[model samples]
Target: MSEALAVVETAGTDTTVPAVSGARQFWRRLRAQRAALVAAAVVALLVLVALAAPLLTALEGQDPTTYHPALIDSARGGVPLGSFGGVSAEHWLGVEPQTGRDMFARLVYGARVSLGVSLGATVVQVAVGIAMGVAAGLGNRWVDLVLSRITDIFVSMPLMIMALALLAIVPNTFPRPVLVALIIALVAGWSTMAKMVRAQTLTLKNLDYVAAARLSGWKTWRIAVRELLPGLAAPGITYAALLIPSNISAEAALSFLGVGVKPPTPSWGQMLTSADVWYQAAPQYLLLPAAALFVTVFALTVLGDGVRVALDPRAASRLRVGTGRRRENRARAAVPENALPEKALPVKSLPEKEGPA
Candidate 1:
């Protein structure tokens, strides 16, 4: 028993585990995160719906904007709500106020706006933030100073109030939903991502890879594009993925405030707005849009969290951050020199009891 215990202890202390590549390990961890997988699937479904919104909402060859008197009066109009008295067979979501449009079809069409705004805004935000952060981290003293001050200014401001005011002015000129999303993104979405990118770039700028690239006469832009940016990829992707929900909420808030996508445009927020007064009578109307928004935001948050955990450089680290390499070497050093366990050495049968013999 004593020998077996000693052998078990020795085996447990060995550290001959295989080390996988960082990228492959990250992917493996991500695939294991069930919440992220489900969220990704949900987001993919929404993207598909956004792409097919036109076909999804098509009613008798009429587009979502087309107003049909019979359809409207009968709760089949392309609206974003259904009537309260009796659910319409054709318009599962019901009819809109006064217009009596088919709410289901409009809701179907509304997916395009929600997804378009969220995705486009995120893209714009990432692009602007990446440029700003790269510039700041590339050792531009004056540029860093200016951008830092700008970031601080926005950080101090109330983003929502500013977004609403801007939306009121901006949507009138640019009726395009994507453009409106882009504008909102430029104002609100860029700051956080920019700060993150700048911090990351600052850390990575002095790395040996960057030094090698510079020594090889690589241009600043090429280094940033090829070498530095890949280092930023994991965090950037995580941030951008989470940024979609914020952008979506911003669009919804704008719509709720009556400045988003104008009338006749179907949107999750618009649907909620129209149902706010009627929620007491029919709660489902409000619940639908609210639920959609909830799912979108929750999904993004989950995906971001999973990504952070999966891509964490210290995912395998049990030691302190700076002590990682030393700990790894120490672990290797702690491994047993013998391949066989001490107990497995034929258990020395008490020297075959030679004394008794």
Candidate 2:
């Protein structure tokens, strides 16, 4: 058993487990950050709430449109505002100005639309980006050159202006908010992914693993996925996740400008729009949605930053300095029990080379 354990340890056959352990280590590092963990927990709970949003008010047919004026009209009715306007049970966050809509229910319902657009846009972005990236990556030199230049052209295009222009051209009947988001995101997403994939592909094209596979006569797509893609997974996940916030922001901006998700639908931006007329009279109505937007964006950005830091090889190297001495001590104690003696040589300047001359 001991000999088998030593063989397994020395032969380095459990390479696949490192991927799993690295993921575990990432979560462990994230957990070490108390604030980030709490923020992450809140984000998770929000995701759950967003998923069950339909059940919260759907069965009885309650929606953002559900208005209760008599309760809202009272100075201290069932709806109460918190510190923003003082807590009330009747219409939490108070009622919308003049309309007396249940801001609480509307806020909850808005989660669906906000999350839907954000997620849907992200899905489209990742799909289109990955396809474009992979195509640009696999193409010949001239193909890569032309594709890259096209990406640059799109990069130079004014995104918001383009979305507005495209929306105007595609009749309002056809350019629904989701379609608008998909189009705008596709343009931005493809360009960004193409550039990144090109750079990565250029670096990876000659990597030992990919080269070995290619030399073995593996099909191009098989080598691309089996060897090249695993290396790209870290960046791919991080980038796709980060792009979500941008999509959400675009949705909100378009909604604010009256070109986004149609009104009457519960959306963060549309929710805020309802208060545009009397922000002074009913500040809670506006502030709540805006705060929600800010928190969601902030959480996603920080989470993305954390993933980038953890995924980076250089960042992972920091663990050595912090834990090196302890590991060294353990190895020293275990040295006598092993067949080979450990040396005190510096790694970067190893003095010995074992080979036939």
Candidate 3:
């Protein structure tokens, strides 16, 4: 009996469970959230649309800059003619009020500018933030103080006002989208990321592995690159995901205020700027770009939240909230009974027939 029990215990111990990698686990958790998956799909579609702007415009046989005067009603303040803002076979999404530019063409092309600036700005912000954050976290007392104070100063400044002031002074000779992205990055984009990184670094630097690395005579740069950076990636990626929508909104606000991308380039915000005056005459003009912005922002925000939850172990419970029962059932079915803990094993009752006999 003792030998049999030992054999059973060894069998249980010998069963090898396949290890799931961190990336795979994260992907699984993210995929489990239906809303996040849908949002991801929507974001992907928008990105595809943005990237294929020229192809889409070419297929529509309309250039963003070309005007179709006949499609507009000059007699009535250049309101688009026909029903639904002049939407027809030739112009799939109708034409602009005064200019008669193809709405579809402008919208698809505008996506390129909006997404380009937002994504570019995000990259700049994240790069600068990590550099500043690591420097502050790893440096001595005075270094931390200087960087932290600078970060606080940037955080406190009025973002919109500073962006406006800076953009207004910059020469338009520079590539508009790149200039806008850089200005956005400079004014207010990086402070949050830096702060988060600094806090995380301060905590991570005290860990045993980091100390071990230090004792191993590793340089500060090497420790930061090899030790701290991997630890920082999760939060950095999560924060970066959240930052994209904010940057998109900022870009739109700047453009709507006439300080962003100029005309002929066709940004969503620039479209909204023109759309504002035409709301009474042509609601589609306002509604199209407004809806596009709302959908993109909403989708991005949802996806970002999903990423945050997926990356955080503490938040794992939140993802399981609605699907708890199904997940539990699936887990119970998938896990072999023998692989369960010894404490969970069934206890066999001794035979009592011999005593009665």
Give the clash count for each candidate. 12, 9, 0
State the local distance difference test value for candidate 3: 0.91
lDDT, candidate 1, at 305: 71
Top of the candidates by lDDT: 3
Clashing pairs in 2: 78-89, 78-90, 79-90, 79-91, 80-88, 81-86, 81-87, 81-88, 82-86
Residue-level lDDT of model 3, residues 9-91, one tens digit each, is 35457543446677888999888788899999999999999999989989988999999999999999999999999999999
Flag the better candidate by lDDT, 1 or 2: 1
Look at candidate 3 and tell me the lDDT of residue 142.
Answer: 100
* Candidate 3: C-alpha RMSD after superposition: 7.7
TM-score of 1: 0.75
Q: Best-fitting candidate, measured by TM-score?
A: 3
* Error in Å for residue 245 of model 3: 0.5
- The C-alpha TM-scores of every prediction are 0.75, 0.76, 0.87
Evaluate model 2: give its TM-score.
Answer: 0.76
Pick by TM-score: 1 or 3, better one: 3
Error of model 3, residue 159, in angstroms? 1.0
Clashing pairs in 3: none
RMSD in Å for all candidates: 11.3, 9.2, 7.7
